[model samples]
Target: MSEQPKTSAAPARLPGGNRRPAGGPPWANAGMPAEKSMTFWPSARRLIHRLRPYRMALLSVVALGVASVGLSVYVPKILGQATDIIFSGVIGRRLPTGSTQEQAVDGLRAAGNDNLADMLARMDVTPGAGVDFTALSTILAWAVVLFVLSSVLMWAQGWILAGVVQRSMYELRAEVEAKLHRLPLPYFDNQPRGELLSRVTNDIDNVAQTLQQTLSQLLTSLLTVIGVIVMMFWISPLLALIALIAVPLSMIVTQQIAKRSQKQFIAQWTHTGTLNAHIEEAFTGHELVKVFGRQKEVEATFAARNAALYDASFGAQFVSGIIMPSMFFIGNLSYVAVAVVGGLRITSGAMSLGDVQAFIQYSRQFTQPLTQVASMANLLQSGVASAERVFELLDAAEQSPEPAAREAAPTRGRVAFEGVDFRYQADTPLIEDLSLVAEPGQTVAIVGPTGAGKTTLVNLIMRFYELDGGRITLDGVDVTELRRDELRSKIGMVLQDAWLFGGTIRENIRYGRPDATEEEIRAAATATYVDRFVHSLPDGYDTVIDSEGGNVSAGEKQLITIARAFLADPALLILDEATSSVDTRTEVLVQQAMAALRTGRTSFVIAHRLSTIRDADLILVMEDGRIVEQGSHSQLLAAGGAYRRLYDAQFTSAAVDLDESGAAAVMAR
Candidate 1:
């Protein structure tokens, strides 16, 4: 029977629909609230908790940020004071020559500074000077020093925060990796590899970038806003009230735009994953596409996905782009309003010119934080969206729980399936009330037509899929009672699609038994006839293979995987169409190697070729998930049942092909 791919659970959606929405960009759904409202605080709380290990470093960043903003806010006030001193010197010029000196001396004497008063009495004074240039220079020098100090603090904070962000991301990546291992195989089977890749790579990177680039600024901007607000009130409460009006207007605009843009960003990443999936699928099946003449269709599909991605990306970015410009407009309006009001108060003699100037600076600073907050709104939303995607993967259903203790001893390969009932979906039953057994040191060959549940039997034995009802036992112990690791370690599998990583041939062979010695590795290779080709390569056993095993032929790659299983020396072996891809000569050699490997071990062989399993201790024929026949090859052939029909069909087809070829040759002659 042809093997059917196992059905798995419904795939998880990553925020948006699997593809772009049918209408247009996400904003096309504007005026309607999102299906699920996303607020920043929840994601923020989770992120903070994830970074709790680095809280001390975060606190240091906050402290440095406060110090930096404090210096910045104070500098403007100091500059305003210096301006007032200069203005006073320029405007009040009458008593500067001699009378001013007498007044200064009298004031010093009254304040009990007799020594300073005596010194002032002796120095000659100029009649009139515009300003005290020395004092102004000192104040400017102090301002420059504060600016440098603030800059240094800002740099230090960023340097430390980088470490914090990197370490947090490292932990997050590790957690995702661990989660992948624990997740049930169905999770992988159902989900697209490209989507999963995006979550692990793109989504995590988004979070990292946001934390690194925006985190420090977010803290500093907030402190600047608060400090500036207090300073504005100190300068003039009436003007401070006027500047405060811009805050709500900026927030309202930011919220309305953000609501729409957040949906677009989610759509953007979703389509990005879809686009990636298409690219991956096309490349993986490029040969098939060429043979089937589907290149044009593939290109058209890719163009459609690409266009969807561009639309979503453009919508998100364009909407977010408006925020900064809108903020600037509002900020300018507020700045002008404050300047006009402050100038009026200055002219009325209620506020000094210096005070008016300081208030204007404070007003500018206030608007700056509001603008920054608006800018960060989109970035934070993207980060939070990415975070939610990651967390969803981490929260997927894991594999069945392990037993608290291993109640069964190591398996001796006496496998039994009793009263087995299974199904992929509730309404579709695949295996119904089945039973079977394989004794130790026996080779059981399973043959069936396509969709006959041949591979599903092996899957059940390997515990890849849990049976809905019934128990499978190994060595007279329930397999479920055995620890999963303990159960899997004792069985070795060689699949139809041979996989080799980007490593030396020797390393791939030693994958199962990592500590296998060089001699054993070579022995396994030699036994599997892999060494024949290995010696032809430039580096023999050390020849490096590409990730796709492009450096070796398919037959050679299969031999290497067989060698890997041989090195493992599992107590039970599973070969599902193992020799299906090999040439006739290689198949004979592989059969020889498999015969040796099967000695004294129980094995399950799922194959269509009747010739390969002719010497099996038992042959079982399955159809529609039921065992229709079971016997030795000779006995099954003698019975003239399902096994006989299958054997007859294969050989008959081969004989007809041979006769037709000979007839064609005769006719040509």
Candidate 2:
């Protein structure tokens, strides 16, 4: 048969099947910065690269937040102006910035100083400035308007901030998940499930949640601090100088907290995963715990893990919690000092009343952002830690993008392995330089003790694992050159475990062939003898299976799986005989179904009972990953080799009873 190269690609689908979901993208390389922990701070370029895609929206939000903060900074000035307008108009003199009306009135000796009374009259505003209230009223109205404006815009700014951060994190989560699907299978096998879950769910959530709180606050605070400092100098350079001294101290505190907390946060997340794993395991094995009477032991283990988690939590959060109150306390003290000293300057005639009032207000505006920065410090560290874990997983090596080619012309189902050697890792070959062939429509049986690489051979033929040394071909085409789905479509497997997903029976059967009709499903079920038992159930084909289908009998599950395989109509079938956990009654039904299904197909049967496979066209005996004997059962028996030894052991065990009629019929086939 000739092979035709088809170039059509599999359409990628997203997780949960809700959206046209692309799971995730590659965020970083897999093996860079091999540190003790997954937590890492991205470099400036990496951070910029992540932000580059959302630069436009981010810029707009930041600009709006700055405008909002800027609007708020001018609020106190109008209040000071109101105090001035009230005192001057009522007393007919400039109000003392502290007690202006009182101070100016005290300056006169009352007898010769009628000018002082005139000053006091000017300061009075009992009926209010009705006609001349234009400037003062306008200033007062503008102040109220600005306050309202800032509140509304700040709400809008927060909405935009949350939207940007959440959408960005969603994008990142998608990329990371995609990377997981494409990653080498060994990576998953090596990593813990809870840790992986933490990366996808918890870690990604942390980054997004923190970004909402921290990034916006950091930007607003930086702008606020800058604007406040500028205004402070404009108000009183000497007071601004005093505030600047406190700024450095704030920086010193923030830097120290950040450096210490970042490490603690990474450790905290890791411990969270460990603690989660512990609880999940304990709960899942509740029966085992009760049987073992190890409740105290489990409680102790949980306590130990919980204690570790708490230590990390306290260390990470305690440091972060300290930042806000410390900044605020120190900030308020500095503000008061600036107010007292600035007031003295104005009293001594070195500074104006307006200037001192503005300086105190400016002191507040400047320190506000600083206080925000200290508050947001923990979230910033947490976001960094979570981002690092996500990026690490996304950077793993993906499977080959191009798939192997399947022969277009229908196949004879002949499989040939030539000089095959394979190992999951670099060292310790599972199979060393093995060679074999299964002819079209022939039933080949492979038998071995555990760890003999019997299943490894099946995996290689299915292309689940790549051959280390040589090649495998179905018909005349190398399997490596076939499209993965196209190749898999031609082969059907009933694994030893008989995995049936949680769904209706029809759905599980249709998983192998989505286009399979209901009529076809029933016919396949009948062929496998599954129809007999299925129809007896209340729901028939529509019967629901729970997780692993625990309600159903194991043999019934295996029969349904076989029905599915039969429905798939693959040219080659792999049946691991332990699917029903083989016993006397189940063995007969499974064998009968398999006999009907294997009539015209090439089959690989992994049999636990040597008696079940005596009639195989070819029998391969394996031990320690190498074929020790190969031939038909009679031929092997006559030779009295490893096959003879195995047969003799079975005969001695008295556990196996071969049906002479069934054995003869299978051999004749």
Candidate 3:
């Protein structure tokens, strides 16, 4: 069974005597600020690196893009040739029948129309000939074939790229999951659950979408731009240069707009994570909010976060939205210039009418791709911003590595904390140079006030947190020398909150030991009083527990956890306020079951009720982080120290309550 991460120190008060919430520290709820602009390139580079494994697929996509774009670029030129055929036919038809082209040109020149004469001279036309219907039809059919081929190649490229992106995302998600396990408990303590979840779920999903939508299109657009530029230069260098002018202008516009929008995009996603955190917290504690009549406060907080998200999202989209229109406007300018220049070149006979027509089409192709690329800048920025978040999570500090040579599992549960010094914060000492030894088969009951390091003690025993100094040992073997899994395997823990996953009661009990037989499970249930309550239900042990375990009473949940621990039969057991949730009658039964379970095992019980620990083999009274008194319960009470005060404070109040209730009952009689 996997050991659960321990954040039991959540109940401990900080140095300033302020209580920290179970979820996280206060600063964790504060939204992250917008990232610096410089991170964009680094994050983009890292995202690109994630795709390195798919190089073969990407190369295939590139090849298909090139082939598709080459055909598409050449088709426009072919269509332009068809246009020339129709135009030349119209001019030749207007001339006298059986007249040669030379005669028509000379006639036009003699008529003082040199421009028309020059243009006609450049064309390959027969005098009095009409349109070449058959040739035009053939060129059109070839153009259609090229278009179809180009489309098929583009579709194939998209399919390959989509698969590559999904696979990359799949690997990325797995890495994040592994990273989460490797990260230390303090990392979770300092981070909001919803915020971390957003990076894993929402951000990764957005990255997948961004790559899916943009990768193939970006490749195609870039290839189309290159192909169009080559065709433009071939047809007319002067026109190509004019068209190239718009490239720099588009670049300038895109750069300026992107600079303004990048931070906004980062802010947008950051706020999304923050807002999700708030929503999660609010919903998770919705009962507390209603019971305390704090719904208005929750709503107000949600509205503030929601509004911040809206502002950031609107700013990002509005700024990036300017690129496509600006690109179109610039493209139109280049188009007009190319048109006028191409007309002049045709009139001067420097370029053929067919060539000029092709140049115009090339200009549109070039500008269209540029426009497409510019429009995709928003998605690219947003995706990279999300990538940065995921990378940050992946970069979190992980726990120290386990020793290469591991100690064997401890058979005798002799636990010792030697010269152990620990602090949640570096400067504030909690447990300092504390030494303790629990001999095998001893029930060490620890009694302490709230935030007196009760839960932290058990956590240290489980190796949940590393000590700043000193070592903890089990059966004369250092815990650090043992593999965490091997060490944790011999330990069973039941916390104040009885956690149960969504499953039947039988399955939950079986979770303690997957290999446990049905007889063992039922025996454990019977010992813990779970069998009594479970059998009363229609499904008995088969009754399904919801995610929240709402169907079972709080006391029943605690009993189920006790049964689980009993089934585990670990050599060492830690119960952190395990019986705190049950009522008086059930607590007695649970304590009886615990006594039977603790017979041969070493047990560490953290409790607030002095009555429960009165018969403990050893009772250690802790104040702050030190054990002020240690002895049997009666011995500590006789010493009349901290333990005596604590005992009096509890039993004295109980006696007074009993007397008051008795007098009230007498008056009623």
Candidate 4:
């Protein structure tokens, strides 16, 4: 197992007063934005660097490609030599013998020179003539040998390339995930989950898809075309000259098509990502759409996104569709030119009939590789676009600078925020001129109406965001000076909405401290009243949970979260609305477990409902990002300040509700 990157904020509040969202997490600052078009503008060397480690495999594939094209040169020669051999024998007035030479030549010589006797004599046993099997046989045997070798090497290349592409994609995604784990809380505040998902899943896939489908093919085609063209010129320079002229003409046409299609493909990919984001957002928030009756609007938005993708895809593919036909026409033109010119030369005795046949074959050969190379160009562009996205993710700024080792651990947990100020953006300060302190082993209960920056204070303690003014210290040391991982290991947290990753109940319970044994897990669970719930289930602690812990109730989720923190046993434990969502009975159970966990540890409890914070060593009442009033519950009530008013409102409402139900009970009696 890998050691997870520690986020700057220790396990503090989960960004909400209660479970899940306080509207959203706290996404205030985002680095580079994804470009609207998938037009990757990075140079070739950087793009191919993704494939760097697999150079040996790529080289092997290239060698095979050259060998495959090398076979092309031999086929024309084989046919040409066979034709030459037959014509030569007919001119010599003899038939070539398969079984030794002299007997057949003698039989041929017994007949007149016009009777094919001299043809046999020339084939073998003649003074200055012999069969020309060497050239024909060499061409045929090499063609077969090259065909088999090319297939084997290409297959091997495919397997090797797949591994390189897949592994790189996996590494890229895993690194991004690790960064997300380390990134500050503010980074997630206002961001959309669907947009992040696009970067990890869709964007990475695009990069890998480009490599797997198009890049290796392009390289292979390029090598093939180069090798075949060289051999074609070598065979007959005059015919090669005619065939080469058609290349530039054909290329000019392809270049125009390629440029247009490249733009189209870039737009198509961007629109595709947009389309995915819209669909993902709408589907994930189906309940919100239904409650708001925004179904029609969402549908309209989806349809428009879908239409844009379709138009872009059609345009790109359609533009590319013209390439093959154009190349085919060009190829045929070269063939016709070769045949007409070579035939006149052969008749004028300046060229052999065999040479004319060979030139025509070579002309077709030249276009086959060139046409494939041109057609693969669009696919090449798509791959480069994907690579750009991958590189962009790899190059994001670090969430926070790594802390140096000279700093010591904050032992006492005596946290103080002195005249502190914080802002996610320059113009908007969330917490302004705030000052507070939690002496070691002290319980600080933070209460507020809403948006009081209650949770923001928790963030400040962990140094998740830098203070704009003043400073916060932990045990006489500036919290920022300590390494983030070592700083967080000392703090434990229990949130209202606990995210249980897919794992067994026992595994979830020990998430905070993975080295915790079964005995420790059971003990922690018992303290949190989680073991009781676990025992009630058939599998007990062995039960598996999904990402949301769907098999368990909301109350059970909170218990498991508490149990997890209990096991970690940190110096500071933050209970950010852990019991805020539970029923009265479950809340009491969770509170008991919290009490056990809080012994010998400093705790920060951010709560609503007001009933639970009465026992806090200090109750800090906050409003509009500042602490308005704070004291013990009785003291605040006696003073009748902000805290007293809030307490009175809850008590009065509870009394009235009891009376209404009490009267109904009396009537039934």
> What TM-score does prediction 2 earn?
0.83
Residue 508 in model 1: lDDT:
97
Candidate 3 lDDT, 400-429, residue by residue in tens: 897786646448999999999887765567
Tell me each candidate's TM-score: 0.90, 0.83, 0.94, 0.82
Q: How would you order the candidates by TM-score, starting with the best?
A: 3, 1, 2, 4
Candidate 4, residues 1-669: lDDT per residue as tens digits? 011111222122321332322332322211124333334445335767766777887777667666655664566766776666656545434434444456565665565433344333433233334555675577567667767776776777677778877887777678788878876665454334555666677767766786687766776766666765776676667878888888898889998888788777666766666676677778867879999999999999879878988998899888987888898899888888888888766655456666667767777777887787767666766666555655555564555687678645447778888888876555555778888888898889998776677777786677666677888877777778877777778888876667899989999988989999889988988888888878788788888889877799888887888888889989988888888657898887777767777777789999877888778899999887788988888888898888877787778968988999999999999
lDDT of 2 by residue, 360-394 (tens): 77787788888888888788777777677676677
Clashing pairs in 1: 1-448, 1-449, 1-450, 2-449, 2-450, 2-451
Q: How many residue pairs collide in each prediction?
A: 6, 27, 0, 11
Question: All candidates' lDDT scores?
Answer: 0.83, 0.74, 0.87, 0.71
Residue 204, candidate 1: Cα error in Å is 0.6
Candidate 3 ranges with C-alpha deviation above 4 Å: 1-24, 27-29, 33-38, 405-410, 654-669
Encode model 1's per-residue lDDT on 207-310: one tens digit a residue: 89988878888899999998898888887899999999999999899988998898788777777777776787789889999999999999998899899989
- Looking at model 4, residue 303 earns an lDDT score of 90
RMSD of 1: 6.6
